[model samples]
Target: MIEENSLHPETLAITSGRPRNTPDGSINSTISLSSTFHAGGVVGYGRYGNETWTDLESAIAALEGGPTLAFSSGMAAISAVFSILPVGAVVTASNQGYSGVMTLLHTLQASGKIEVRSVDVSNSDEVLAVLPGTALLWLESPTNPTLAIADLPRLISAAKDAGCGVAVDNTFATPLGQKPLVMGADIVVHSVTKYLAGHSDVILGSVTTKDPALFSRLEDARKIGGAIPGPFEAWLALRGIRTFPIRFEKAQANALEIASRLSRHPKVDQVFYSGLASDKFHERASSFMAGFGAVLSFTLHSGVAEAEKVCESSKIITHATSLGGVESLWERRRKWSGESQLVSETLIRLSLGCENVEDLWSDIEQALGNA
Candidate 1:
């Protein structure tokens, strides 16, 4: 068995996936560019089950502390999970879940293959009310754009008792900060496009689970759906993952300071950050997250119009979509999310990067000035 020794994520980022390949034992793991290999019977036919891909899978599985599978994108992983639901199965989810996911559910419901109901994920009562008939409890704590956190442990307990499988979008928190599987969730999904890759170059997704049944179902969906990542992309994601600990730490430090400063800004109306003491998500995050995380949402003093101004006026901050890279990103949430309550007309989403905290804040403070 190939084993890796890692104590901290920073350590893991450097040490993980590195095998002793040289006769004298080299320190780094080599990237295998091979597209196919022998199964000890015949030549491998395609990208499916390639050596490099399998090595990437093994590294990810080891890091997540569960059996993990890679996919083409975060949406692919999510869609693979939805593929498991039987016809007419019901999924109770946060109304604020990712818009793409909500759209996927709606599409399924429209096709008569599934039923999806949206509700406030933070309200235990709201979620529990539908648990009995729910086939899946789709959850996103500190939900997209709104930064609303659900009572994860409570929901997991209730969902299990009701015979509903639970899946948590752990992207916002990243595994560096949160482990939903360890906290009783059946499946943990991530848009590796965000924090996991740490770079914007690769779009990937992952699902980690202890349940073999759930793993088998998702694995089948992955193989049959033909959404597997290329060996090189997987290699890139694995490489990016090694630096996750350090990148995550720096970004989070910047985020906490940014959130603190934003709350006090005269031009800011609302700031949503789990790290904020005043935030609704604070207590839950304090208890559940290893770190408060880097993503945040806030409203400008002037709402939508001001939001557009902030996006365009900033020189250092780029008004763009997407998060979890080495550079700062800013986006008007409402415009991108199509009016879901998760993203308000006045809201701006910021994904803090590895840049100097002082610099990022200076840009934000200045941008908010004219807004």
Candidate 2:
């Protein structure tokens, strides 16, 4: 057997969890479509277990450097974690994190199931101040839409000292860009529907952990909640992971070029990509991440009308909501009802793809001309 730990992540991405040649000399693992296995077998039912899911989970775990559990969607994985918390347990989360996470946290808080404290994750002092009373510290570095970077080492250390568990939403910075587990986080979460799947054809979420007890608890929650991913989705995600490193590299390069150009564009007010030297999070992002990621957000000098026009004016770039696809995507985030009020109405979030840099630039230039 090959030693996966000795190999680079790029190598692991392709080789990990792959089966050796079968009796028929097949290289690819076929999707197990059976919903029920034979009686007295290790996997008696599809809902409980499947070979396709196992392969996908193993691949994710190898990249994340821990054991992993897959769910129907990113929100399902997040909800499973929250469900494991005791009633009224205090959880501190990023104020500018993903809107879906915030909405769920707010709903839970309203019902008095948990005590939620929203804090600026970028500010280590603010995060530490609330740590004493917090049962869990939720982190989202390079936060959604805004791209605010968090100081994970400092916050994770403080949370550990305070005896609080730390969970980082590693959706924005994929495992290839950043490893939260190596940074001392207790758990790392990913919305595999995004970058991990790369093509945006599948919806899946995963949680990885080094702690056996926590992994057991999360697995129990997943099994009981019955929010497992489909076998086909898992297979597609595994295929996507095989090329994640290469896809991420191209996307990052495209994003840096786009962000640089947007920063100097006359109609642009500000660009929020950590790859840019002028970005507030650039320094912190450089210290921790292997790459600055593929997503970037910028604000227009004009208001919502101009932003909407820019979104509509794009020729090559599609104006869409979800991101991390093979083709470039951009949208005015405020149009979403669940978007954070912190995100400005004029802010445009862009998800760079593997498309040619010059072509993407031309599309953006044309869009900004209308703005």
Candidate 3:
């Protein structure tokens, strides 16, 4: 049985989706570096498909509970979603959305195809206020940099009522923490480059949606967008996904501990992690999450210059711009170009990894002390 032979997601990282032993008895899934996979001649070419990438695609689609389409980067996934909008259409989105998303919207507007309106994603009424004219409602729960949370079901219902498609950026929560498609999302999108890829190596994106109609439209756009991910990138994402449950478990634990320590640290002005009781979303997080996620935001007591020092002084945490990796990272979100002013200039976002909590705590404590 699959249950007996398979490891739970944690153990599966070391087992599932592997190439079975050849008669010679090998255990690992060998990387098929070929640009072409022509087993039945039906796979014919690599551009439209490949055997290994197809296998990885099927696995992730199963995990997300919907039909899927993959892309080279998270932005490509998002662009594929944006491609379906007709000229003069309207789109409703979050105030806390990823910075690059704003850039895309600017491009769409300049092309004379759409109008973009952003609102506080948690405030369902505000999102609904402009939904009547919208072609899409973009929700980013536990949004980037700020970590703000959104109620998926309510937003989806509102969008549906208005005849608009709902796309939830599920990168932060990942499927293990939240299943947006099951909850009513028209489409569930990810920067698989982050949590799903887990290792910070693959730069990929995916969109999973239950509606066959929407899937078809997005699928056509994906093939032409020429945003397809490389075969190896898909393989890497597939490999990384096996460890999600464990990676998330350890990262969540480390995040909570680090949040608690920083909340009490004298050199810290405030922490923005939803897992903390002091955050507005703590109750919602408690009700919805298996646990709080690994990303946390904190501000240095002295302000922007001191915030930069926290990044410069940290010993154990890497001061970088990306998140959801096996190694911890720290960065000033406001300074990350294109991010909204809502991200406090003094705030430094931390992405907790599988590292020992004590070491993370020491590094953070010492870095704040430098301020």
- The true-structure Cα RMSD of candidate 3 reads 2.6
Summed backbone clashes in each candidate are 2, 0, 0
| Cα lDDT for residue 108, candidate 3 | 91
Task: Give lDDT tens digits, candidate 1, residues 242-267.
Answer: 78888889999999999999999888
Residue ranges of candidate 1 with Cα displaced over 4 Å: 1-6, 20-35, 39-43, 337-342
Per-model TM against the reference = 0.93, 0.98, 0.92
Taken over the whole model, the C-alpha lDDT of each candidate is 0.82, 0.91, 0.81
Candidate 1 residue 76 Cα shift, in angstroms, is: 0.4
Model 3 steric clash pairs: none
- Model 3, runs deviating above 4 Å: 1-30, 36-40
Candidate that scores best on TM-score: 2
lDDT of 1 at 3: 49
- Model 1: what TM-score? 0.93
Candidate 2 local lDDT, 272-356, one digit each (tens):
9999999888898898888889999999889999999999999999999878878899999999898988889999999999999
Judged by lDDT against the true structure, how good is candidate 3?
Answer: 0.81
